[model samples]
Target: MFATSSPPPSGPWAGAARTEPQPRAPLRTDLLDTLMRLHREGVAARETRRLVPDAIEHRDLIRWEQRAARELRSMFDEVGWPGLDVVGEVGAEAAWWCVLLCDRLTAFQRDAHGLLQDAGERQAAPARHLAYLDDRLLMHHGEPQQFGTQHQLFADGCVEPYPVDNPALVAERRRSIGLPPTACRTAALRLLSLTRGPPLDDHR
Candidate 1:
């Protein structure tokens, strides 16, 4: 098991005995909001499945997955993993993968959402629900990164190149700029492509 690293406390609670657990920090508000949104989307996706609209209705699953992936990417740095500090320069490597995965998922969701929107009434909900739920599942199970592999970095039109001559300096500049790490993209993509398909049971 990864050893737990306790963050230093600056409040009066710091002196409290270990026997009495310190109150947990108020959850990161945005992270909580993202989770809530993801859950709401998941429910809608599930309801759609119950209606069993049609094969085309499966597109909803794609949309939800996409949203989850995007939201997760937005929160990747905030959700620091265990052992990251000791992982040395490679620490942020895993994060990059997740960003990639989320990006792919977002793309998938947009495509599916388009389909769902164009679809008939019976097809709409299921497609959205499926898309969202699948995304939630994928986000929950973010995969480990194979850092040495050929994954690429991305920044969806928000990132700009730095003018540094040194490669390392340039990379650091890129990181400081607006770019989703490689891991986020990889994880989101993996989840979406891996789970892309029709629902088994028709809600109808």
Candidate 2:
């Protein structure tokens, strides 16, 4: 059902990643329960660590499990899980917040995966060579040809920031987000804004 690390009791959900599919009616329900428990436990651990600074010093593996389990929850939650709705005293907004948080966590999972791949490639490079790329940058330490390839890759990233605003690109992004095509693009710009070298605005 998800990726898991070896060595038992590192976390309560150690074998959860090995869960297999079963008949949709029974298995789906069981999966929903397992996922909910995993998500709750992960969040509880994270909150405890944040409140108690020594939590990680004594329990680094638990902290890692908490992070990984949280990611698994996010991946499943993005599917719009139907079987595990909370019968809450809390309002609908609370459920929505959970959904939003899960979505953000899923994004983090994707970003982390990309980062790890880049790190692996960099580590394999010869002494004087390196490469990396993302929404933010395409850094390299190699010959001109390798730098040129990186430049092309960077340019090909669909959502990478541009120095000069392209109204059409901005409009398309807004449309993807369900905003009106004609709405002010500045709002979308705010989301992609990155600070480098030095802060340019008083808002910093």
The numbered model that scores best in TM-score is 1
On a 0 to 100 scale, what is the lDDT of residue 43 in model 2?
45
lDDT of each: 0.31, 0.27
TM-score of candidate 2 to 2 decimals: 0.25
lDDT of 2 at 166: 41
Residues 1-204, model 2: lDDT tens digits: 001111111222211112211112223444445445544643443343221224353253244344444544564455332221221112111222232222223344344334334433433111111111221122211122211111111212222222213443644433332323232232222222111212111210
Task: Report per-prediction Cα RMSD to one decimal.
Answer: 18.5, 18.0
What TM-score, computed on C-alpha atoms, does each candidate reach?
0.30, 0.25
lDDT of 1 by residue, 1-204 (tens): 000011112211122222221223333444444555565554455343322323444466556556666555445434432111322212222222222223324443343334333321322121212222333333323432211112221222121111112344433432332212222233322222222233321120
Worst 10 residues of 2 by lDDT: 1-10
